[model samples]
Each structure stands twice: as structure tokens, then as C-alpha cells.
Target chain A: MARYATTPSQTVGPYLHIGLPWPDGPFAVAEGTPEGVWIRGVLYDGAGAPVPDGLIETWQADPEGRFDHPDDPRGAVARPGFRAFGRCPTDANGEYGIFTLKPGPVPGPGGTLQAPHIDVSVFARGMLHRTVTRVYFPEEAAANAADPVLSSVPEPERATLVARPAEDGYRFDIRLQGEDETVFFDV
Target chain B: MSTDPTTRPAPPAYARDAEVHPPLDYPGYRSTALRHPKRGLRLLPHLLTEVTGPLLGEDRISENDSDLTRQHDGEPQGQRIIVHGQVRDGDGRPVPHTLVEIWQANAGGRYRHTGDNWPCPLDPNFSGVGRTLTDDQGRYRFTTIRPGAYPWRNHDNAWRPAHIHFSLFGRAFTQRLVTQMYFPGDPLFFQDPMWNSIPDEKARERLVARFDYANTAPEWALAYEWDIVLRGREATVFEDEVDED
Candidate 1:
């Protein structure tokens, strides 16, 4: 006898609802911003449960590792039609995704050009404080090794912060707790 | 620009009728299993008043109040800046009476009570948990000190800049958001993983509040104004379906 496999419903889990909360106005400025990059990822608990209401915020550099604002003293490099900033809350399934460009290496303290990475902050209801994490690209392995931040983590744990490239772009998953948990700093 | 007689004319009335929908006995399908009254009833009041509290006066007790001392204890201490903002809906309107909670590291770059052991002294006065309600203007404010930059094992010579973490709940679960706010002049903002995660330039600036000379109190106190928004009732839409697969 042949048996059929039953698939579960997709709408049963938690969803994330995010938006921009800027004091000035709508976060739209025509010039003096970075290029658009795609920032997308999933949120999960230590038990691998999707946190539907989890809120994630990401900030990174433009492709040149230089910021676009006038205040950014790194000097001006123009990339027309690119907007570096965006905000989105995850859906109920604990899945959050954004479309932006990859950032270039930026100067760290002591004039060091830090590796290309995106800074992330995660907020969920039950969490006492926000969890801070980073997402690195796999292609920049050499740079990742040289990264002052990545080098601080143990060799085995470094892989947790580096995202693997997927068909559309890169995929990074963050775990709030438990084994294989991504290293979260207390900044 | 020039006005031209060759401009296209509006479509005829008959064409518009075809695109209109007639009222139906049942507008859309409903699911029995997921049906329930909305949960915003309890959260609405909190969302409305998050922004309008008495500004924290000078000489206020620190958010943390523990009598522990030692480095690498992961206690919350050090100088830190807390940026609180009110969240608004798509229409740029504030949803009042919400809850905003924030927790972050001490000046020495350690959290209040996490297991991580970064070598930093925790302040007995700073517990690092802050709560506030938005006011009638959809505004929320937090009184917090500046977080300190701490070193991590990720890099031999890397240290995170001072920052604060934020968690916001609007009128309902669907309107919640979590994020971190950074200081404007911190040099480490560029190197930190959390700050660089935001891809947009203008949006990234939004995370860093402008240093308001007027909001600055006497040398001892600092103040920041942050606003948050939540989706209102009419804007919410529900879809009914068991499974697509």
C-alpha cells in the first residue's frame, strides 16, 4: 500500500509586524544615503521555534564601506538610486527579510578596515534585553578571518555569524538561546 | 512643462462599472480555528501615553541598584545613552498608550545578569531595565546612562561601542518591534555588527538620534526623545485559509 504525506498549515505560527519609527519624518531622503542592499533572515528560539513577533533591526555600510551622509567623514562616493536604510518587522512565522546591497569594509578603531558585516539587534517580548548579533557573508572568508570581531570568537563558533549564500542572496539564521547559539554581545 | 491639447482623456463611465465590486452576503471566507477577538484591548492605553512622562530630573537614582563589584561579572554598568522613540503607522500617526522596555550593557560593556563574563565592573545603581508609556502625542522617553564599549573574543583588537537595546509593544502583538539605538559620535558605530546591519543610509541615521542641545540638561543629566507607532484597528486585515499546500 502507498501512503501520502500530510503537510501542516503555514498560517498556524507566529508572525512579525515591523515598520520604521523615525522622529524626523518618513525615512525618505533623496540624496546623501547609501545604496540599497538586501538584508533578509529568519529568527528562531533555542528550541528552533520561529519567533513570530520578534523584531529585528539591521544597519550596515554602503558597498564602498563608506557612509553616504555629509557627517560621514570617510569622504563622498556617489551611488545614485541607492538607499541604504530600511526597517521591517518579521511576519508571524518569525521570518524577516529586507532588500539592500552588501556593505564594504569600514574603518574600525586604530584605522583598521573592519570586514564587511551587518550589525543586528533582536527584540522579542519575553526577552529581558535586546540581543545583539552580526551577519557575515561566506564569500568574504579571508576578510572574515581578519575581522577583529570574528577573530574574537572561537573558530567553531565563527561559522554561526557567517551567512551562507542562497539562490536569491544570503541566508543567516539567529538563535536566541541553547546550543549552537550565535554569540550575542552585551552592547 | 507645456500644456498640450493631445493629452489623453478620462475613460468613459461604462468602463469604470466593470471594475467595481458588488456587495456580497459574505465578503470573504473565515476560519473557525483561528477566530478570536483582537488582543489590543489591554495594550491600547499603554501605547497612547508612552511619550508623555515627566522628563527624568537630575539626581535620579540609577536604573540599576545592586551592591556588587568586580570585573567580568556581566553586571550592567558604565556610561550609556538610551534613545527612546515613538512608533507611528503608515500614515505617520502615533498610536498612544504602549509599553517600551529597554535593556543593555553597563559602561564596562557587560549586561546586567547574563552568563557572559566580560571583564567590566557592574554598577550597583544601574539594573539596566527601563519602562515608559507614550503620551497623547505618541511619544516615549527613557532615562538611561550611556553603555560602555567592551571587548569580545571575536577579534584580538575589537571592542563594541556603547549602545542601548529597545523593545516596544504597540496596541497589539501585531504592532510590536525590537531594535537598538546608537550614539551619534561613537567611533565604534561603524565597526559594530549590530549598527551596520541596517542596510539603508537614511534609515540608519534614524536609529541615531541627533544630539539636541536644548534637551540637554545640566552637566549631570542627558535626555533623548524617541517616538514609536503601531498599526491601528481599521488598517488591520485578516485572511482566512487552512493551508495552501
Candidate 2:
């Protein structure tokens, strides 16, 4: 079959905040929902400067490992108030936050099980294309160890994908360049 | 052990084509030098999490969200234009109900952002932000003013070609794309490093929107048509195939 080539990606430029952010953007679940934790972090450039113009988006399953998408083989999510996606732009100080419930384990390829993680896409002024990454929970040590994606990453660099435990949730800082750069995926 | 006949295997992941996408380390865009990752990206397996994406319901978009000209009391200043396009998959199937977002400079090439202080007057009525959901036919339209060329510090007297920034989310997470749309036959293409970064001349032309005289409203606004094609899921997923390194 002759398929059409997908359009190329371009930088989000410095003015992304004008269009990307949503009023209820950071909240994957409704505000003040019990057990909802905030995933917070700061985006940094190679020079160690904060990136205030960046945007971060997250996609995750519900606590039961079910998605709200039709592509999920297990079935569509029926939860009334849960929003599986979140879009948050960095503040002036280069900080971003997402309020949501932690996701459970999801199905992986080759009959393996993926650890609790949130799929993230990073868009910034300098990035020609959105960088794909993941946020893993620190508490899921066992599951993280057995994850196929984590296993594929070099042993020393795997820590960049795991979030640190914070007051109400986890903190996963993203570094676009320099040492300890976040593990970007080629998916 | 028997496999369930009713449950079809999930679709394979869409691999990003390097030839079409600009490199992160393109020196033409100076900001990329310090911002691009020094290391290569790791490969991720297509799983339930990757294939499934958030379906942004229609509720998020309110009335007049698609019409930037009607947001304020008075009309925005500039030549009014109607930008319309269709979102499709690699297989040429319409991707219906997807979200399309756009932000651009006002007719004067001045952005509404606080960071943009290039000595240009800001339009109080034009915010330069608009979003809409594609219809059942995968088509989306926006009513707005045509933006002007803007000066940038990339080079000596570098003025960016008039363009509109676009952000799109296809059905799946892997199908996310962000790009810019240009007018057909802009004289500024020769000096714009961002536009020149694309190695392929033909691929670069895809970013230009065609002037649609047929769709132009009699006196209200001129029309420009462009279509966005996104990576589609493979027809048959090979579960056991190893990724070629």
C-alpha cells in the first residue's frame, strides 16, 4: 500500500504558552479529588537554566490499568471523572505540575508487564520535535526492575526515568541536555 | 492453549522517519545547540500505554473557540483569512474529532506573549490563540487575521516569514505533532533558517498552504487550504519482530 508520509515536526517556539495551556490543564483528575497527587518538576537546559517556555503533556491509565481509548484491548475506561491526559506549561520559574492518581501496571509486548508509568511528551523552543519520555514511580521497584523498557536502557542511566518521592506524589525533573539527561524514547 | 479469536492484536507503534523530521542538533537554529540532547534516544516498545491516547472530549472547547476574530468586542486588525485543513492518517483515512490548536502573531507580527518585546505595538483585541475540534470528516477551520513577518535575532535583520504555529493530537499518543504553516510563495523562505532546516525541498513545500479561491467567502475573508497527514498504525502488527538497530 502506498502510504502518505507524515508531516515533519517543528519547534514549538518561544510563544507556546499563548496556545497550549488549558485552564484545567494540570489536573488529570478533578481538583480536590481524594488520593490525587501532584507530579511536579522543573525543566532545565544544558546551561542549567530553567526553560520557562516549555510544555509537558502526560498520558496514563487509570488506577486499574484501564485506558479511555478504544485501542486498549482490555476495553475502554468507564470512570466518570478521570481524565487520562494532562497538558501543563512551565511557569516563569520553569516549574510544572500535574494533579492525578497514580496509574497501575499496564500490559507490555511479548506478554510482559509494564511498570506503573506516565507517557510524557516534552515540547520546547529549541526542540525540532517533541521528545518522548516516561515517568516511573519510585515505589514500584520490583515492577520497574522487570519492565522491558527499563531493562533496555543502560543500567546507570535508568535512574533518570524514575521519579523521586515527594510530599504528595513524585518529582521527575527533566533535563533536555547535559549530564543526567532524561531518557528520551524513539517511539 | 488457544488464542481468543475475537480479541485482535494491538497495532504496532509508528516509528518516526528521520528523513522527514529535522534533527535536534540543527545548527541553523542556535537554541538547539545547548538544548538538544547529546545522547541518542532509546527505543520504546509499543504497548497498551503507547497505542492508547487521551480522547479530549468536546466539552473542553467552548463557543467561539474556533473563531479568533469574534473573541473580543471589535474585530482584530488585519486581512481576515479562513484557514481550513483536513487531518488524515498514513493510510489516507480521516482522523475525526481530533484537537487542532493554533497560535500566531497579530497582523503586525507582534505576539501577545510577555517575552516578545520587539518594539511592535500589541493588539488589545487579538490574543492570537485559538483551538477547535476536527469534524467527522477530519476537517478543521479557523477564522483569523493573516500574520505579518517578524524580526528575529537569529541573523542580521532576520525577519521570519509570516506563519502560524500549529499543534495537533491524532488518535494515539505516538501521533502527536507540532508544526508551522506558511503561505504559498513567501519571499522570506530563502533567509529563514527554520524553514531551510528541512533537508528535502519537496518535504518543505508541504508546510505551505494553498490559496483556495473557491472556498473564499465573497467579501468576508480569503481561504487557504492545507492537510496534515499523521503516522498511522500498521495494518498487521508483528508481535515477535525485533526492532532493527
Query: Tens-digit lDDT track for model 2 on B163-198?
Result: 999989898898889999999999999998789888
Each candidate's lDDT (Cα)?
A: 0.48, 0.88
lDDT of 2 by residue, A44-158 (tens): 9999899988999999989988888888766687687789888999988899999999998887766677898999999999888889999999999999999888878998899
Off by over 4 Å in 2: B1-9, B235-245
Write model 1 residue lDDT over A1-187, tens digit each, in one string: 1011111001111112212222211122232244433456777775667766665655556677755433233334555544344445556687876666777776554334468876665655444224457788899988888876778777887788898887756788877655666776523
What's the TM-score of every candidate structure?
0.40, 0.95
Residue pairs with clashing backbones, model 2: none
lDDT of 2 at A85: 89
lDDT (tens digit, per residue) of candidate 1 on B2-90: 13211312111110110011111111212211221111111111110111111211222233311211122553344333355565653
Candidate DockQ values, in order, are: 0.02, 0.63
For each candidate, C-alpha RMSD in Å? 25.3, 3.5
